[model samples]
Target: MAVRVSTDTFEAEVKNGGKAVIADFYSDSCVPCKRLSPVLAEIEEEQGDRVKLVKININFDGALAEKYGVMSVPTLIFFKDGEEISRLNGAVKKSEIVSEIDKI
Candidate 1:
């Protein structure tokens, strides 16, 4: 499962530090976000130590959403060494996500 984070811990946990992270910015009412959740979980399970998965609720963390310029839900951002390296927006397939992770 993806680790849920709030704005308070986002900078400490995900920004400019730690291992590679896949940050999912989403809203509770979004259908695409719901659909992508399982796919992210599967990626986390498969990658294990290679990466970390984080789920950020836009409604709960508006500041983070604004910081990332998340105009839409289900925005998947990839971070390496605390810097954003890549991103995937919307309900993407498992292969596509894996491809991005592989690049990192």
Candidate 2:
């Protein structure tokens, strides 16, 4: 399973990790978020050592959503060295997300 984070763990896992990070900013009510959940889980299981999957519930942790300008559900943000590199603004395929991260 992906490492699910809340407002409390955001900074430690993302800002201080000093590695590439992929965060899924979503809400419980968003269907697309649910749809993307399994895909992310699979990716975590398959490539856990290479990339860290961080799942954040927007409703509970609005700080990151607002900070990242997440206006929609199933937003995927990729960051390296605590800085954002790219953002996918909707439910996306696993291959697509992986391809984007590979470039980073």
- Which is the leading candidate under TM-score? 1
Error of 1 at 19 (Å): 2.3
lDDT of 1 by residue, 1-104 (tens): 67789988887778644568999999999999999998888889999678888889999899998998888989999999888999999999999999999999
TM for candidate 2 is 0.91
Pairs in steric clash, model 1: 16-82, 17-82
Candidate 2 residue lDDT tens string, 1-87 = 577888788878887655678899988899998999999888878877777889999888899899889888889999888788998
**Model 2: CA > 4 A from native:** none
Q: Estimate the TM-score for candidate 1.
A: 0.93
Query: Where does candidate 2 clash, by residue pair?
Result: none
Tell me the whole-model lDDT of each prediction, alpha carbons only. Answer: 0.88, 0.85
Query: How far out, in Å, is residue 62 in model 1?
Result: 0.9
Q: After superposition, how far is residue 59 of candidate 1 from its true place, in Å?
A: 0.3
Please list the residue runs of candidate 1 whose C-alpha ends up more than 4 Å from where it truly belongs after superposition: 15-18
Report the Cα RMSD per candidate.
1.4, 1.3
